[model samples]
Target: MMKYMKHLLVILVITIPVLYTVFLFGYHNQTQTTVIYHGINLFRGEEGGDQPLFEKREFTAPLSYVILLTLTFGIVIAAVAGLIWLLFSRWEQRRRLRSEKREERKERLYIEGIEYYFQGDLDMAEKIFEKVKARFPAFISPYIRIADIHYRRRDYRKSLELLDQARVNEAKRVDIFLRKAENFLALDDLGEASAALERAAEIDPKNLTVLEYQRDLYIMREKWEEALEVHKEYVRLVKHRRPEMEEIQNRLQYEIARKLVASEEGKGKAIRALREIIRSEPRFIPAYKVLGEIYVEQNRAEEALKMWEKAYKEHPEHPILLTWIEDVLYEQGAHEPRMSELYRKALEKSPHDRLLKLFYAHYLLRLDRVDEAEALLGELERTGGRLPLFSIFRSEIYERKGRFKDAIKALKAAYGIHSFNEMVFSSGNGLFEHPLHRQRTVSWYTWDRYRINTGQELIPMPDIQRVHRA
Candidate 1:
């Protein structure tokens, strides 16, 4: 009703002025003579006669002029409106096309960047990514690609900076978090990596990728307790949502067992965890290995030997079993008589391994068979490369033969390849005795002090010496 009233009012306003003008012209031009009714004159002129006072009234109305003016003004207004609409439409189309072109160019650059990355041309990839970023400042692909290039080049710090620079809207924040976590993991920054994963979990707690990364980070940090907690969270996350996720379940169970054993402060807990893992996954060699190590650490050499024997029964071609057997026998003070037999058997099993030959040589030297050890070392030298322990053992052999210079040279060679930090090695029986312990202190900040301590101890500075020559 209100709409109709408004329309009616508009129509009255438009027609009133024209209608009044027309009425005025009609009244003046056409005389309204009073018609006599019963000899009475109505609306008469001033004179008594019909045309006495008012001479014959004659006026012209320019109706055609008004009609022509109205049509001309209507055409002009219509033309102006049409021109404005056409200009606006053209501007809008141009703007849309520009946007579409920009999107296409960004996509093309993104593809090119990916290709360059795959080709292992990180420089080219970075260049392409920068171009994409310049062309499409709103695009996320460039940041991701550049970060990946940095990561692949092992410039982890730069990669992390790139990841931090990534822009993520509400819709893409979860993805950004996951990618950031991946970059942190690549850099071995477990704490930050775990935090990123946790953020991703907060966004989408049921995300399996995020959960897996969290678990992996915990494991990398050697935070077995935290790893178990993450495992439980993962279980809760996927509960009933993916009931058929058997692979996830199995992996979670295995990792749980591993973590339980790792965090165990007592031998009882370690043994229990190991037994549970074996029952769950009979073929898990790591479980058996850890159990044997725990036994050995506790001086239960017989039990450790039996565990290795069982492992050997399960896997007949296991070379590490022989290594363990030799270790146990050496610990039992039976290395002299059994050294030759063990070396011969191990060599027969794996003849091409230089490390095996080196170990055999060490045993031979300990047995006072210097000539035999020399022959083995010579054979090892004939091969292409040296084993991790070969140089140290060789140095010991040289020192025994009263060749102090040769002994020092061999020790220098060993130090040059893998710098042995005295603090790290001395604090807790060193790398070889307890390799897993090193995992807990993998941070540069923690290990940096160890290297400083090594420097203080006057440990050989082979790297520094080389730098001086250069």
Candidate 2:
């Protein structure tokens, strides 16, 4: 019965304005009749019924009187209605203002709590926020803000507690799920975080924030397949919001493909996955490097070389690829002539690269070009570089060339920079019984910057060089 009364009241309230409009039009039409009635009645009373100013028809029936009575009644009803409407409108405005003031007070308190939080006054902040929650349990903002305070303080447990309370209060709010998930993530609770993200995604799959964080969770867990799917969804959202990330999209695809390869075991399938990465982002250098490494491990040196060469062509200044090329050639120990040519070509492109210069010098030395090796070493020394073993090699070359004094001088300089162990010889030209023991002793003394003293005394160069030549 009450519901029916309420419905009827609503209907009447809606129809009142329409009724008022009809009354206004009806009252306007009655005004002319009332004015004519006043003129006719006055003249009829002043002159006799047959006066020239007053026709019998004008005085007949006093029709304007009825019109005047009707107009008076219409004015009274309109005035009453307008007074009632004005009173009701004022009442309603006051009621709304009161409600707005109450909300404004609550919101101001909530804002004060947030300010306290920002000022690092956690006790005051928590107190004010708790008051808000108690006063307005129906409001989600208090719960959200209080939980955020806990999260900011790294109190994940307390944060979850507040969020749980929020759920108990309003179990259907989407914001609760998101905040809960964020708290779990801050706690490093990936399982809970993933579950929360999944729920949030289910509720509002268009939420790209949830999808992105969930995708990262999947990646951390090494759930590559799930990660790939979620990343695809994220890319779609990104395409809608940011159309300029086309290159980034390709790179994401490449990463997904690479992770797929790493997580799968079948060699054939992994290779195909790697190839997919290359197809998606052809300039992804890591894919090429990994492919080359795989090929090298499989003893397919030629294919490895091809991949490295391609990488070098794409990024010509990449030292790692150049190093790979030199390493591959050195391992194969073939085509010495081509190796030298390649080394020179790479050095010409990057003259200041010390590693390239070292490789080039070694390649020249391997070809028995001692003079070139010595000249290169000299250049490195002039640039204040330190090559510990190069001086020894130069000294050996000098000794082989019969430049004994230059060899000795080079040996002395090498000794000053590095430890030069002297050889011991017997006059009878017999070998030391324990060469290993003597070498170990010499190495230790040399490393300690001490000269090796045989207690027996020092030996001459003639016999030492003779033994060394032997």
Candidate 3:
């Protein structure tokens, strides 16, 4: 386009000057010429001179006719130039259209590759894309397609080689960089993967896919600090926030806080970040547990108890909170008053809550409040059927009251266990234990799901504080 503009400018530069000169020199009127010629002739006639050369002026026309003739000449020249330019433009446009049509025809084979790819005929797709690659070398789609086929076939090195070729053909292709990064990640080449992602980010900084990939890469490398930063940007750029995204952000934030807590210098910042997470995500039970531990590690028992109590009061189903609270108070023999009042208040709020009532029963039995514990057990059995933990809790009551034989009878009858062993109980360690590691010990928390990590897949907590507040 700039070339065409320069040519037009040159034509204008030459034509305007010539047209201006003609208008300046050829602007003569016939009246002025006639007066001069007649005056000169009259003088000659008076002097008896026969000068036939002074008859008229042939070069000058009338004023209006001169203007008309000049306009006509300009119109003729302009028409000729305009026609030539129009013809040239049409020819160039046709040439471009033909080239585009040829490219489209080459892509027709690419369409067959796509059809075969979706049909799961990878071998044919590979062949078709290879042919397309040879014919349409400038375009990166065929290379991308072939690389994808290799990736599906688990030929990661081959996939990467094709992607490298694509990158050479089109260095600015973000998809090429993304695919190369993926292939590198699959091959466990973090250095190459990082380089690819860095290039992609430089090309398009705000790309959501690039941000997600970076976030995952950092997380896989256990670079919690970097992962947190990338995840924050990802969350900010997301148009619609999803529950899974919230969960991911929570995990990243918690991982960072955990790392901070691990370092002596970062404990205070970790505490602050954990508190922020707890405020925004009250249902996230791990944040509460970790924050409590941090306080306990510093010998800040009072603060830890207060924090755990605050959380337990809001979410009674999370047995971990109850465990943390009672374990602190039980050793000192001061759990009665605090735990009693807390359970009373929780029962008042959720009176129909069987889990809370059952937890209170377990606490009572552990304290040797056999009568109250028995009453709750009977109510639980009558209203909500019996759980294995219920039988275990009853045995706990009998054991607390010095009825060892009946405790053994109750456990054996409920679980049909043939083994015999001592059940060591501790408020801090566990509620019940098998004698020689032959059976799984029952924990004081008596959590629902067994055989998993502590505090995992516990009951879903209440929604006093929802997610995404921050």
Candidate 4:
């Protein structure tokens, strides 16, 4: 009801003025007055003739019609001006809404492009970013994002070109310089990368990301001291230390120590550095391993054994340390009792560890404890152990026991699991069905060739050799 009333009021306002004008026109003629004039000669003959030749008549309108006409004209002029103003206001509103919608579309595209970029779909991200750039030329994010994509593709020149376009503003942005630094670093232009990063640092001195980039640059140039300083700065700025930061610092020290170990004079320095690393991070196994090796090279057998034993006690699952310890003990002719006890104790601690069980079984075999080794191998087989070496060891156990058929079966199983087969066709063709095993045989041959080219050790198959001889 209110809506109808509002519309009706508008119609009334417009119609009232027109109706009043119509009423005034209708009544004006009825109320209008006419005046007539008669003139006589008062001057000479010329004046009398001029006066008689002319008779004057006049009509006068009422005051109401004159006022109505003036008022009607004013109303029409005001209505026209109001209409124009209303139209212009609506047009302006629509233009602003269109601009807002365009901005919204550009923002959505940018967000999608970022998602694709992180998901590793560089091509799709580039296309979307390019569309955004075309549609919204002043939106700087798309230009920078596209440049980053080009940087990832290693198209450094194209990346720089896009970055240049993004840098049209007078003041340089931190992100723009950071991206330039990344591109220069990828191209191995360390000096330019450093310069760009420094400029970024100047713009935002406390930025952790810029500091991280500077640290990486220092590491790349092998300036460990500088890298460490920058890393410390980064930690200070971030206000919280990350575990990886410590690891990176430890690795930097390790490398420095490794380089020092090259000279006899620097061996002492290397040892001191290694000791420092171990003191800081006791669980750092590589430092202990290297330190043990250094002791062995120096003929300090007792020292090497002590260091390795400490490492094994700390991290019992480290197979390399176990193997190294076993080798050293065997070389010293003291492996039988000591190494066996060590393996048994490790197995007790980590009973379900496959690598530990396998190593223990191998150690048992070395000690001529065939029954124990066979029991472990049986457990491995039942539990679906897929390592080819497991099958190979099982075959070895069978051969030692003089179970020729079982030995052959185990060898065939090992062959099936074996990744490389350079000798498969040459020595074991009788074991495999000719046509059925064709693809498997070819795949094995290809793998064998790859292993040989890559200098990987081939899997041992002693039973296959015996079968070939038979």
Better of 3 and 4 by TM-score: 3
Pitting candidate 1 against candidate 2, the one with the higher lDDT is 2
User: For candidate 1, which ten residues in a row score worst on lDDT?
Assistant: 461-470
Give the winner by lDDT. Answer: 3
TM-score to native of every candidate shown? 0.54, 0.56, 0.59, 0.54
Instruction: Show model 4 residue runs off by greater than 4 Å.
Output: 1-139, 149-157, 168-171, 181-205, 217-226, 364-378, 388-470
User: How do the candidates rank by lDDT, highest first?
Assistant: 3, 4, 2, 1
lDDT of prediction 4: 0.70
Model 1 clashing residue pairs (backbone): none
lDDT tens digits, residue span 34-53, model 2: 22332343545544666555
Best by TM-score: 3
The reply for model 3, stretches above 4 Å from the true place, is 1-83, 235-250, 263-265, 326-470
Looking at candidate 4, the ten consecutive residues that score lowest on lDDT are 461-470
Candidates' RMSD to native: 14.8, 20.8, 12.8, 17.1
Better of 2 and 3 by lDDT: 3
Please provide, for model 4 over 270-357, each residue's C-alpha lDDT reduced to its tens digit, 9 standing for 90 to 100.
8998999898877666677677768877999789887887787887756456766876777788997888788878878888877678
Error of 4 at 405 (Å): 18
Candidate 2, residue 200: how far the Cα is off, in Å: 1.4
